[model samples]
Target: MIAPTLHTERLTLRPLALSDFEPLAEFYASDRSQYVGGPKAADQAWRTLACEIGHWTLRGYGRFGVDETSTGKFVGMVGPWFPDAWPEPELGWDLMNGFEGRGFATEAGLATREYAYKTLGWKTAISLVADGNTGSAKVAERMGATWESKLNHHIFGDVNIYRHLNSEAV
Candidate 1:
C-alpha cells in the first residue's frame, strides 16, 4: 500500500520525492550531521534518497518528508528502514536544525509508531542511534522504547539499539 500523508499540529509528514533534494540538502550539510552520521555531499545525498525511494517499493513503507504546516517548508524525514544484514525493522528520523527542540520528532515518531502497531500490525520496532545522540535516544524513550544492546551497524557504523514492543504501552 502507498503510505499516506500524516499531519501534526505544526508539521506535515509525507512521502519524499526526488525534487525534495534541494531543501533536504541543507540538513545533510549541517552540523546536525554528527548525530546523523555527518553531512553527505550532494551526490551522496542523492544516492541516499534514491535508496530510500527503493525501500518504499520493496518494503511497502519508507521515510516521509517532514514539512512545517504553517510555512509549508520541508523540515526533515521520519519512517521505517532496514539496515544491511539487520534482521528486524527499524524506525528512523532526522530533523533540520531550525526545527529541532520543538517536539516535532517526538510527535511524528509517536504517530508513526501508532501506525506501525495499530494499523500495520507490527509487533515490534527498533531504532539505531549513535552513542552520543542523546536527542534521538530521548525521543525513542519517550516512544516507550528501551535500550536493547549496542551493535555495530554496518551501514551507519557504531550505534546503540532501542526498541518498542507493540504489546506494551507508550
Candidate 2:
C-alpha cells in the first residue's frame, strides 16, 4: 500500500515523490549526510531514493518524505524501515541541513512510531544510530527511546540501537 499522508503540529509527512529528487540528491551529496552515509554522487542519491520508495512495495511500510506544513518545504524523511538482514524494524529519519537542531526529527519520529505500532502491528522497533551520531541519538532519546545495545551493521558499522516502548501497551 502507498504511504498515506500524515500530519503533525508543524509538518506534513507524505509519500516520497519525484519532485523531492533535486533537494534530496543535494542533501545526499553533502557532508551533512555523514551519519546516513552520504557525500555520494547524484546517481547514488537517486538509487537511494528509489530504494526508499521500493521498500513500501516490499514491506507495506516505509519512509515518508516530511515537509513543513505551512511552507510545503521538504524538511526530511522519517518513518519505519526494515531491510533484509536488519536486526529489527527501525524508526529512522534524516533531517536536511538548515532544519537540524529543531524538533522536526523528534516530532516526525514519534508520529512514525505511532503508525508503526498501531497501523503495522509492530510490538517494538529500534532506531539504528551510527556510533557518534549524537544528533540522532538525541532525537531518539527525546522520542522516549532507550539505548538497548550495539551492533555492527553490514552497511553502517558500529551502530547503536535504541529501543522504543510500544505506546499502545503503555
Candidate 3:
C-alpha cells in the first residue's frame, strides 16, 4: 500500500521516495539529527530513507515527505509509523532544520494523528520522543498527546512515549 499524499494548510505530505535522499542526507549530516539517530554518513542516510520506503510496503503506512506547498521544498517528514518493536502505531514528525519555529511540526502532527485514527483505523497512537527532545515533546503535546511512559530502547536508550488521542476523539 503506497502512502497517499496528504495536505495541510501550508504543506504537502507526499510519499517518501529515492529522490528524497539528497536532502534527507544533508539533514542527517548535521548535528541537529542527533536526537533521531543521525549525524550519520550519507550511506547511513540512504539506508534510513530506504527503510522508510520499505515501511510503506510492509505496513501499509509510513512517513510522508513534508514539502512546503508554495515552494515545493522538502521541509520534513511526518506521519504514522510502526516498526515491529514499537508498542503501537506512532504519530511521528520531524521538520527540517530551517523549517522549525514555524508550527510546521504541529500542523503536520495533527494531520497525521487524524489520518492514523480515521483512515488507518488505529485505536491509539504514540510518539516515541527521545528524552531531552523538548521540541518534539511539545509537538506531541500540541497534537493532543501526553506522556505515557518511558521506553528503554537498546540503541537510543530511554525515550519518552507520548500517547495520542484515542480514535474516538477523531
Winning model by lDDT: 2
What is candidate 2's lDDT per residue for 1-170, written digit by digit as tens? 78999999999999998988888888998989988988889999899999999999999999999999999999999999998989989999998878999899999999999899888889999999999899999999998899999999888789999999875653
lDDT of each: 0.80, 0.92, 0.87
**Could you tell me the TM-score of candidate 1?**
0.90
Write down the lDDT that model 2 would get: 0.92
lDDT-based ranking? 2, 3, 1
Indicate whether candidate 2 or candidate 3 has the larger lDDT.
Answer: 2
RMSD, one per candidate, in order: 1.7, 1.0, 1.0
Clash pairs, model 2 backbone = none
Worst 10 residues of 2 by lDDT: 161-170
lDDT of 1 at 141: 88
TM-scores for every candidate against the unseen true structure: 0.90, 0.97, 0.96
The candidate that achieves the highest TM-score relative to the unseen native structure? 2
Ordered by TM-score, highest first, the candidates read 2, 3, 1
- lDDT (tens digit, per residue) of candidate 1 on 42-101: 787777778777787788887788888998887888877775687588888888778878
Candidate 3 residue-wise lDDT, 1-170, digit = tens:
78888998998988987878888898899988988998999999999998888999998899899999999988888988988878777888777779988899999888888887788888988899999999999888888888999999877789999988798875
lDDT of 1 at 42: 79
RMSD of 3: 1.0
lDDT value, residue 91 of candidate 2: 96
